[model samples]
Target: MGFKSKRKIKTNFVSAANKKLRLAWDRKHRQLTVSDWRKWVFSGKTRVNMGGSDSESFYWSDVPGTNRPHQVRPQVQGISDGVMVWGCISGDRPGYSTAIIDGAIDSNKYVEILKTSLMQTLE
Candidate 1:
């Protein structure tokens, strides 16, 4: 036995915590399958008078003009994929970067997490 030092479980715990943080930022992190983003034809009435009316097929970015203050709208012209991730994170640290340490989001890891969470709810 050529063991150098004692195995620290706290160190392992901290490592796991860091991974959970990466997961939070990856909630909207999805790979773009195509080189360019998809764009809608957008050929219709330029201005739509909602007039406080509710519609199922409406988006905030649909408004072409930027008049609202503190309202930085995304150019929906570039339709990007926004996937949902059921992971935890420390906080909104910006940059939205996720680190999948040693292929963390593999099929096995996903299945294991699902099983564990499901088991908890059953109890």
Candidate 2:
């Protein structure tokens, strides 16, 4: 006779997230109005923020072999480059897509971009 494999029984457990989502659905179901939607659209105060970032590696790595371990030397090829873009939009108004070119986005650089690009976009 063949031995039967022991399998775990599946459980349908409702987590805290499921409870919260169900409550939110129950509260918001057919409760929104046209005026509420219009206000939300015009205010541009949505729950989501739009943002993006791009990066490029300046150094290359040698392919690793599974047979044995090897020590690799690091090389200074060039500067690590990257850029970040972000913006928001309202119903009729368009937003600005600001891009900052830097290796790291610190507070000082962030403020600089806001002062330069963001201010220009606002104007």
Candidate 3:
């Protein structure tokens, strides 16, 4: 057998309603021209993991031996340490981003980010 160990790919579960909404959104925007798209700024937020990920690892070896330092992953003490960041970009240029200094972003924080980063990007 020519099988090798591999890590499982993680994926998010999309609900049927979410799928329908995405399809509808695509249909609505499918007719938009390049200039129309250029006028749009796509924005999103993600967590930048400061610590190592909590995922399984695999290695190949002909004989069983002690695990090397590189083979072992560090275990974080608490919740995965990471900082949340928000950014936006247009068709022509990248935009500014800000780290969530205090906590998770709320509606107010989102508006503030839009007022600062998004406004600067548009200008």
Candidate that scores best on lDDT? 3
How do the residues 8-38 of candidate 1 rate in per-residue lDDT, one tens digit apiece?
Answer: 4333345777888888756644553333223
Error of 2 at 42 (Å): 12
User: Which ten contiguous residues of candidate 2 have the minimum total lDDT?
Assistant: 41-50
Q: lDDT of each model, Cα atoms only?
A: 0.39, 0.51, 0.86
**Which sections of candidate 3 miss by over 4 Å?**
1-5, 59-67, 75-80
Error of 3 at 5 (Å): 4.3
Order by lDDT, highest first: 3, 2, 1
lDDT of 2 at 77: 46
Q: Give the Cα error of residue 41 in candidate 2, in Å.
A: 10
Residues 83-102, model 3: lDDT tens digits: 88999889999999989967
Q: Given candidate 3, what's the lDDT at residue 2?
A: 100
Off by over 4 Å in 2: 1-76, 79-81
Candidate 3 pairs with clashing backbones:
none
> In order, what is each prediction's RMSD in angstroms?
24.0, 11.5, 3.1
